[model samples]
Target: MSLVLGCNISTFDSTTAPADLFNAVRDQAIAAEEAGFDVVTIGDHLYATPGAPDEPTLEAYTTLAALASCTNSIQLSTMVTSNTFRNPAVLAKMVTSLDVISGSRAVLGIGAGWFEPEHDGYGLEFDAVSERMAKFEEALRIIVPMLRGERPTMDGRWYRVHEAINEPRVRDDLPVMVGGGGERRTFAYAARYADHLNITCLPAQLPDKLRALEERCAEAGRDPRTLEVSFATPMVINEDGEKARQQVEEILVQSGVDASMASEVFFVGTPAEVTEQLRAKVLAHGVHRLMVNLFAAGQDLDVIALTGRTLAPLVSGG
Candidate 1:
């Protein structure tokens, strides 16, 4: 795969009225599609996490379904649906439904559930990390086969499925993407079941994560090249490069991210500067796939267009 760029719409402007929220999201998706983005993903959460707890949040699949109606060709998915949020069989069927609705442009991006507050607020069980990974593994066992058109029947500790039949699937070869940074369980799961692995880590940690993923792929007797690797980072771009840098600082402070670690986690500057930073810090390290959340742009159409226009060429040569 070449350098595939995606936009992750993880935040919503709190100022937007409830009735106009979906329209705002739809516009952003359209902007992304027109700007040359290959995919537009939404975060799955009952409530916002990286932002204010009371911020307006949309359910990932529901929003994607709506976007499918308004947008033409851009792929739709969750940044990652929490495995804890839905039953594995049901989630599999949902993605299949999305695929049909989107003209075969749905990708299943999922992860072991995180964000404790959301779980607590919703009365869902938030287990320890190891326990969550255990459940995640079982979920994948059921999910992967179903996506491939198999009727998987497994009685696992956390989930049980009895020849779950998914109907109306647009294609059996729908891509499954696993997002996380754990080299042990996450990478192993990705190697075993996922077509794409979205590694969430700082720039400096990417090399080690990729190496671990390679090792896991080898252990699974799969070619590492078959698994597309991607890195997602918070991005802020402006014509005024200094202003963009200032926005980055403000975001880091607001998010309580340590100032010393800003460069490792953020891509902020003019379009050219951000592109160069991505080239040196991400693409050069062998991760060709990139997903960026435009934290500073919000629902701004022009900024999103500018970003897509500038970054889309990164993959053109390939």
Candidate 2:
């Protein structure tokens, strides 16, 4: 598989309007497509803070509806939808509908819900972590079949659905990607069900995480290679490596990342530098897909455009 670049539109302030966010997504998707990116993805969060503003939380599926209409080639998906927010059968229908509208370009990336504050504010149950995992597993059991055109019926401890048929059945085999890094539970769920497995980028912890995933895949009688392993990192690109690092540092300051450790966590540098680092990580860790989250919201569109025009091609082997 070739390199993939996906930008996650995460707003750090509530000042951005939903319409503006949608327009940025449209423009960015077009730019990414024109720049030769293989996928355009988004993160799912229903919360508001300085780090995540925009009230009423621009629902992911609604944004996806607009995204489906705006872009043709780029695959659209959430980085990971929290399982606790929506009913599984309902969530399945939403994505399958997007698949239908997008001509089968939708992928579902889901996770056990985190962010207890969002749950509490939204009046949703903020279950214990263990219970959340069970709910997540139950969600997969209910969602996968429904999207595959099966009229699913399920009676589980946390959820109950009967003979639910997702209409306008997904136009293709919709990919289900589960996101997390829990050695025992998350990887096991992905090994058993996910088409792609995503984890946060923490280079120090990645080796052990992949090892755990490998073991889980073995226990599930599945080839770990059959599942795509992906990581998300923030990228700062410019002609000069140090200049790019400075740009990333500025963004990190805006995001309130600790001044000392921010640069170490992000991919901040020139295209060649980022590419060299990515190549090393990919080869060393067996990572096949990489999605870089561009924190360019309320920043320079020129930078975003340069990101696609310059970095996308370099990393995509064009």
Candidate 2, residues 257-307, lDDT tens digits: the string is 775775467766776777777666554666646676766531445556666
What ranges in model 2 sit over 4 Å off?
1-3, 12-19, 49-57, 170-172, 254-256, 297-301, 309-318
For each candidate, give its TM-score against the true structure.
Answer: 0.97, 0.89
TM-score (C-alpha) between model 1 and the true structure: 0.97
RMSD of 1: 1.3
Question: For residues 1-318, what per-residue lDDT tens digits would candidate 1 score against the true structure?
Answer: 222889989888888899999999999999999998999999999888677889899999989999999988889989999999999999999999999998999999999989999999999999999999999999999988998989999988999889899997868889999999999999999999999999998888888998899899999999999988889878888899988778778777778887666677888889889889988888888777788888747478888998888788885553
Assess candidate 1 and give its lDDT. 0.88
